[model samples]
Target: MSDPTRFIPVPTPETAHFWEGARAGELRLQRCADCRKAYFPPRAFCPECGSREVRVERASGRARLYSYVINHLPAPGFTAPYAIAVVELEEGPRMMSNILDCPQTPEALVLDMPLEVTFERLSDEISLPQFRPAKGRAA
Candidate 1:
């Protein structure tokens, strides 16, 4: 069942490819052709070089937990004691997402722990890219 009160993102021209890739079970990111720097939150230009020469590429779906906080406050469509995390992707970009399939605790979410991408479908056109403990990694 879907959460009626959960926030849903509307895809725009800049982010259309990202949403599409998520629905297809791929993590899409933007890279600066001029500087070869990978970036997230898809944009028309690269933040590093300020160049319009950017390209979209599929990510490896691998990352490491960089940081996180366990939220105990209540929020609509969310359970209490959930982890809000920032993960560093293998391709050298960092993104913020919720940690799933693991305990939302300081001990469970160690820094630099390996993670893998997973999708949470919110609608036909929207799927959130989240992360979980990688196979064989202690959760």
Candidate 2:
């Protein structure tokens, strides 16, 4: 198995701002100035209208649990039974992240549960955007 600890992302020029924002504890996304449509996996132009007038904006850090899977198999840099989830951001974008600070169980991970973004710094220059149960949710 590949070393998960070595699975660092190499940012391209198009995605540099997004990675930079994560390291700085902010969630950044791209919005097309033409269509006002926000999207992820940052690109040079808007995926909706093919407009180059895209701008970087900070996300609200709020999300809803869309779907998830509990991985029981051991992998590099991961413990068994970790929750890998797809979270729908408040701005209408969905991102895949690990659900932290909560048990990785079906009874604990409910669909549509509220979540908030938290950064996990991997290195001096790399920080991963992770999600955790929102404040006030049952523990």
Model 2 is weakest, by summed lDDT over 10 consecutive residues, at 1-10
**Candidate 1 runs further than 4 Å off:** none
Task: List TM-scores for all candidates, in order.
Answer: 0.96, 0.94
Worst 10 residues of 1 by lDDT: 1-10
Total backbone collisions, model 2: 0
Query: Which candidate ranks first by lDDT, i.e. highest?
Result: 1
**How large an RMSD does model 2 have?**
2.6
lDDT of 2: 0.91
lDDT score at residue 116, model 1, on the 0-100 scale: 97
What local lDDT does model 1 show for residue 19?
A: 92
What lDDT tens digits, residue by residue, belong to model 2 across residues 17-136?
Answer: 999999999999999999999999899999889999999999999999999999999877888889889999999989999999998899999999999999987777789899999999
